[model samples]
Target: MRRAIAAAMSRSKREIPHYYLEHSIDISKAQDWLQAHNAERTPEQRLLLGALLVRAAALTLKQTPELNGYYTDGRFDPSSSVHIGMAINIRGGGLVVPALLDADQASLEQLMERLKDLTGRARHGGLRSSEMSAATVTLTSLGDRGVDSVLGVIFPPQVAILGFGTPVLRPWITDTGSVEARPVLRVTLAADHRVSDGHLGARFLRELTRKLQSPESL
Candidate 1:
């Protein structure tokens, strides 16, 4: 596993030209929706914010398709399906990303349930080979660890990786010029510069923010 990871990182560093974009999104609506949704569920069955972020990314990719594919053989190949590779940290140490198949088609509740199942299976070394290799794009979050932001490395063959930082309460100016404290989340995307430009990256972030703010759609 160590050799495989090292080889993959070495290939990514040597081959991919990575460009990063960062944005802070107001997730107040998403938070409110989550809190209310969880009120009727058991503690073990409640949703995690990371799952919502994944759902949002999946939805964003439907519009910004350039960021959701692989780069290989000196060209970019866009994927027709959106299988999100969710990064999960093992209990003892190390990390693994298991693909959540057809994330864009799942309902919010179904996505949360699938995420819980994936994380549990990944930590216990129960992931299938197809799950390990079928990811069209990846999502990593260090928010639970209290990191403010991250500039992630692009995992190769895959053209991009989306990262989420810890959510914090910050003063936000409303359209009416009133300042209010809102829960803001920092999101970053690292993409292959050969396949996409900063303009597309910005558009992707905007769509992601829009999806996150309208959590009802996820």
Candidate 2:
């Protein structure tokens, strides 16, 4: 059904219109924390950890303010809330995104509890139309799928989409200019050209990298 829809949409210029934006996030530091902390949780908790990372990004966006809202009315409205759409399985196949809004303001406990419900509804096809509609931004994971990184298309009207890939052990530079094995995940940020500039995009990645190092946010 999704393939059919995508094909049909592609036949026209404006149907499901999109633009591609690509950027990479080196998550070597964040994975080190996840590997250790993952041992403390059940499988469910580990899954929720992915959602937490997305929520953390929304928090990072909240700080920037400019990157936090949907572009509408030929103008950008700085969202007072941070709503991040989480992509999960669609009915039978493909995927759907159910949002976890205002994550920046939500307490840790609230995020966990709400995410459980959102992810559940998303997989089972019970997600409300409204939940899938009002996404200010997106955070999608392809961990189990084995993608390294994806330069995805911006879901129309939304300014950006974030894609995450599996973490694998690889060699990276140290302060000593030596090599060390680090677990790294690739992140691709796709943005609408009308909304984001090269400098703001660079700033977003810099801030996100700093958040990964904060430890507590993880």
Candidate 3:
């Protein structure tokens, strides 16, 4: 697994003209909404912040097709469906990224359930072939590792990858001009320069932020 990863990442860096962008998103509203929403539910019925991030990215990708597709044979082909590759680490060895097929269509609760199942399967084996190869884009996070941010390499064929960092309490200025400590998530996007530019990437991040801020809409 390590050998395979090294080869892919080496190819990604050598062939893909990578461009990166980072955004500091204030997720106070979303966090608060999630807290309130999960308060009445049983522990097993509650949701996770990662699911919300994935759902937002999947929906945002629908509007930003250039960032969600394959760049092969010197050409780019955009996918109509959004298959989000979730990066899951194995217990003692490597990692596996399995796609949550048609991620944009799933609800928050559905995404949470699917993510749990996928993560378990990825660690224990039994991942489907389609899940292994059908991803249009990938999402990875180091939040559990307590990292401030991460800059990921673009996986081959796919044009982009998104990374999320740990949610930390940062000083933020509110709409009313008061300062408060809010949970801020740092998001990074690594895209193939052959298919898109920094401007488009910035727009994609903005849309993702909008989707995240309006948790009820997602």
Candidate 4:
């Protein structure tokens, strides 16, 4: 596992020119909706905010094709389907990232269930071969670990990786000129510069923020 990780990281740094973009998104609406949504469901069926983030990112990728695909053999191959690689840490050490297939097409409930199942399988060793190799893009989060923010390394072949930081309560100015404490999440995008520029990355983050602000659609 260590050897595999080292090889992938070395190749990523050696071959992919990476550019990063960060956005502090106000997820107050999303959180509120999640809380309300969870209130109506049983404990075993409740959804986490991570599910929403993945869903939003998957949908946003449809608009930004440059960030979601493989770069191999000196070319970029875009994918019509969105398979988000979810980073899951093992019990003792290391990690595995398994792709959640067709994430853009899955409902929030289904995505949550699949994410939970994937995490369990990844940690305990039941992940399939397809899930291991089918990711178009990867998503990692340190929110549970109390990290304020993270800038991730671009996984080779895949053009981009997204990092989500812990949601913090901050004073935000509203459209009506009122100061309110809102749950703000810092989202970072690390993309292969060979395939995309900063402008496209910025647009992708903005689109994600817009989707997160209105979580009902996810």
**Which candidate tops lDDT?**
3
lDDT of 4 at 40: 76
lDDT winner, 3 or 4: 3
Error of 3 at 147 (Å): 0.3
Candidate 3: where are CA atoms >4 Å away?
none
Tell me the lDDT of candidate 2: 0.69
Candidate 1 regions with alpha-carbon error over 4 angstroms: none
Residue 133 lDDT in model 3?
97
**C-alpha TM-scores of all predictions:** 0.95, 0.82, 0.98, 0.98
| Candidate 4 ranges with C-alpha deviation above 4 Å | none
Return whichever of 2 and 4 wins on lDDT: 4
Q: In angstroms, how far off is 70's CA in candidate 4?
A: 0.4
Candidate ranking (lDDT, best to worst): 3, 4, 1, 2
Candidate closer to the true structure by lDDT (higher is better), 2 or 3: 3
Model 2 spans with C-alpha error above 4 angstroms: 1-28, 35-48
Model 3 pairs whose backbones collide: none
Q: List CA RMSD, all candidates.
A: 1.3, 3.3, 0.7, 0.9
Q: Tens digit of lDDT per residue, candidate 4, span 1-218?
A: 87899899999999999988899999999999999999978999999999999999999997888988999999999999999998889988887999999999999989999999999999899999999999999999999998888999988899999999999999999999999999899999999988999999999998999999999988
Per-candidate total of colliding backbone pairs: 0, 0, 0, 0
